[model samples]
Target: MTARPLWTSHEAQDATGGALVGPDWNANGVSIDSRSVAEGDLFVALRGPNFDGHAYVADALAKGAVAALVDTLPEFPAHNPSLIKVDETLAGLRALGIARREAVGATVIGLTGSVGKTTTKEMLATAFAALGATHASPGSLNNHWGVPLSLARMPHDVRYGVFEMGMNHAGEIADLTGMVRPHVALITTVAAAHIEFFGSVEAIADAKAEIFQGVEPGGTAVLPLDNPHYARLAAAARAAGVTRHITFGETAGADFLLKGVETGPEGLTVSAVAAGLPLTFHLNFFGKHQAVNALGALAAVHAAGGDIARAAAALEGLQPLKGRGGRRKIALAGGGELTLIDESYNASPAAVAAALGVLGAETPGTGGRRIAIIGDMLELGEQSAALHADLAGPAVANKIDTVHCCGPYAAYLWELLPAAMRGLRAPDSTVLARSLARELRAGDVVMVKGSLGSRMAKVVEVITSLASDGAA
Candidate 1:
């Protein structure tokens, strides 16, 4: 069966108030990147401070974009390129998103938090996909342009829409949520992820609560009951005219209560109570923090009128995303393989502690060592040094065999770590990646982690490259 077109030329022109040139064409998808534009896609020429998509308009068209949405016409090479000329491409994209949101009947869920927004959004999308056709934000596309781009990409007939909203400072989520107008607003938990911008976690909670501001009339709010800022978020929700609430956590009296969790080599077996009924499910991923994320996701699913049992069952198939606790086995040159846990995406103090806890639970192979390659946790403001130093306790408590610390902030952690647990300390990940790669041995379980700015993935890449090098 032929798929229905996402947008026709007429629809695009009406949505963006743009003048169309060349023959009418239908776009099955929308994209901002010229390099990844797929066949039958509507490419929007967005201008950023560092780069301009207008320069890539020809490339996008030649690559397979059915039509290009642009603020200014680009010079073409002896060909009539289909174009939608608008006053501003960014505004045009936002207009397209607004039109798409109004067109879909999907139950939209707006999610935000200091951490776990991407994981919970993925979980919600996976669970909802089991119930019906679902559309979710791709990766960490939870910012200003990401939110609208995700919305505009949603299929008209989707049954559920899960939009992840993120922020570095105040009021960011509010603007994104206004465009989403979700039926349910979910805040994973308030943490010190971006404490550099906000002086306190309370301020961060208030910023996250902005997700509730655009909740549709009679919409429900899903909150983390165990978080210290739960009350603040609830009050904020009420202030935003959202009265119904669903809370999830290990705390007593939570709407969705996490009763217990058992960790193993494969994943976590979670026991919880939803509303009043007992529930049990297995997540093919590690971390108690993830268990809480699951509860929040299930609560959002429930609030959105989805089947709780089905959603819970679907979680069993959910695995961790790359750079977020996903594990892989790297074959060593001499003999046995070593396990690699990729947590190199982003990190905060709480997130690092949680990762260490997961590391502690793993029973290593015979003669295997539990190794941690840690990069700096960014955006802590005045508390940066103290917070970095505080990780020493979790490392010690978790019984990590060796720790490779990178970045200047991580040096504070290195200084605080016990002499026996210290492996290597470098000024940056690039320096540490080389030494860490050469030091890896058979039967070792290594976990790499850092904030995006820290470039910790380079270490993970260097370590994984051993497999090919060994083969060669």
Candidate 2:
């Protein structure tokens, strides 16, 4: 085989915790999980609070990893050669990422929000791809290790890059922002997510504001005018000395204002005024919430100096992330269609409400009903039950005909809903899903949503299985 994929050995040294020994070898890519290591990959043995990757070094080498960034070398069969010692694997990874960023000089866009950050990252990356070679963080890889891994993965020749930066604690964003030093940053919105970590909503806002700390001097900040904290976020960006600021929303005075939005079976039609230009876009994703996300994309692309028309045109083909409202059509037994709205990846009060709004917009088939198959929202700490129960109001207001629930907190919501609105509730998602599948019929719009920890998406899987087996 060809020589192991090459990375600057010096680059690996700074990114990892230890010293570079041979100075001749390099790595193709950095990997924290040994299972994913491939030939020419640099395996970093990260010892987390609950797990240690050091034990897997031998397996990674056996699998053909080029080098191992480790604090302590694991005993392996004789004749293994790829070992790069490090002090702290995570620190080393961060150093390597920063070193690469300094060397590559790619245009970086930072994105943060309580919701939609991952989807927005994909949207921006898709749009950016139309203009030039681009790189974006995979999934919701916006944490301590994720940030570094994403930055490290960025191709040196990439003209544009997008990094999604997320924080569950107070100082996390500040630390990440400093490392990214983004040229253009976008805050999707501030919602009551991870509120258990902070004392109040204002504290959450303060933490999210930390994304501005990493903005390069004279760089632009993009924010949402419709968010309640819009002014506060804008002020924070300015206080951090951001030289340019842009706003996107349906609200008046936004620099990239969404004038109107119409959703159909095809997708959504967005009329907007951006950079003092009139524009209209037919985006591929569904819902008014997505139109707002598109606005965020527009602002970032424009702030990055790309054409708004081109960005809008590029959004038409963008695919939704699975479990985030990506549509799945299932044919019913009686010659009709059952549309599944998969929002089961995660949820918050704001996101739940938004998903209901999308459900409200969905046009059910003839003689079909709108059903909401929901699970509990996690991470609210003391407010978890109340938040779960409170969703009944939104469900009623949105005209949901039936509500199916699973999980402990979901039981609270089941009790809270009016008698006529309640469909089924079980101690677990399996029973709830079974009941839902039996009751579901053609022309029904079923929305599945809950925190990922609740395992709500399993119900979507069940529905899909039944649809495939001709049981629905």
Candidate 3:
């Protein structure tokens, strides 16, 4: 079936308080970037600190956008371009998003957490798809502009909308959540993810709890019963006018509780209960942490009045995400095999520990060793060095045979490791990439993790190139 129109020229004008400058037109989608704009998309020209999107109005039109939202109209070609002229572009774009959300009429689930927001967003989107058409935040589009863009892109006919809200300082999630007004609000878990901006983990949990501010009347708030900040979050939710609450975790009193979970190199089987109904499903991704993430997803689905069993069934095809926990099996030159786990997107002390647990769960091939290549986890504030060194216990406990590390902060971990497990340490990723490439052997299981600033993906690339050949 042909998708319904997202915006009519009159509707766009009324929604954004802009004036239509050309012939009436229709948009099938909404976009901010010209390069990715679809044929019938409404491209919103945005202005930021570094760059101005208004400069690309002509480029967006050339890319086949049905209409463009511009503060200042650009010079057009022979044919006139459909345009919406407003006094300010960014505010106009946000107005359009709020208008879209009010019109879409889909059940919204808004989630926030220190880590796994993106992963859980993806999971919830997939689970909701089991019932009907679903729309979700793209990538990590959980910030100010990203949240608006995701909302503006929501289809009017969608059955469900899943949005991820992220924040560094306080009140950010509250501001973003006010616009979402989700029917079901969830907090994945609170950790010291952006501790640089906050003084304590309690402050972080308080910030995450802000998602409850937008809970619609009669909607439910999903909390993690296992987290230490549960009471604080629950109190905040009730104060925000959220009446119903559902908790998901392995701890007692959780409405959605995990009974047992078995994880393997390929995937994991989850045995749990959602609101007292037994649920047994398999996740395409590995990681014991994912079991909790899965429970959160199921809780959100159930709270949103979706088909829980069908949603669980849809999770069977969910695979490890790229730049998150993507896995690759490369045939070694010596007729053996090596597995690579890429967790090089973002990192924190908790995320690093979880990745180490995943690495430890898998058994290496015969005559092979378990290797971990790591880089710095940034934004740790005054406790950076101690937190970096804290990896010693988790790494050693995970049975990692060797470790290759890089970055200034990560040097603390290198110094803390025993001489037998210390493979190499470099100041940057470039030198470490070469050293790591040279160290890979057949039958090895290697896991790479670091913050985005560390560029650990380069190391994953080097190892991948060597995996196709003999030694690096």
On lDDT, the leading prediction is 1
Candidate 2 lDDT by residue in tens digits, 1-472 = 6643436666565555466543346667778888778777888788888989988887887787777787776776576565678777787788777877887767899989988899999999988989888989989899999998888877777899899998889999999988888999899989889988986777888899899998988899999889889878888998999858899988899999988988778789999898889999997777788899999998999999997888789889888898988888897555667898999999988899999888977778888888998888887888888888888888989899988888898889889889999888888777777766578888899999999988887798888876655543
Off-target runs (Cα >4 Å) in candidate 2 are 1-6, 14-17, 21-24, 333-335, 468-472
Q: Taking the tens digit of each residue's C-alpha lDDT, what string does model 3 give over 1-472? A: 8767888999989998899998999898889998898898999999989988888888888888988999998886678888999999888878988998888889999999988888998999899988899999989998989999899888888999999999889999989998999999999999888898997999999999988888889999999999999999999999989979999999988999999888765689999988898889999788868889989999998898888899999998887678899888877665677888899998999999999999988889888888998899988888889899999899999999998999999999999999999989999888999766558877789999999999998987887776546443
> Per TM-score, what order, best first?
1, 3, 2
Candidate 1 lDDT, 67-124, residue by residue in tens:
9999998878699999999999999999999999999999999999988989999999
Name the better of 2 and 3 by TM-score.
3
TM-score of each: 0.98, 0.95, 0.97
Q: Candidate 3 at 285: error in angstroms?
A: 1.4
For model 3, the stretches where C-alpha displacement exceeds 4 angstroms are: 1-3, 77-79, 469-472
* C-alpha local distance difference test of each model: 0.92, 0.84, 0.89
Estimate the TM-score for candidate 1. 0.98
TM-score of 2: 0.95
C-alpha RMSD by candidate, in order = 1.4, 2.3, 1.8
Task: Please give the TM-score that candidate 3 achieves against the real structure.
Answer: 0.97
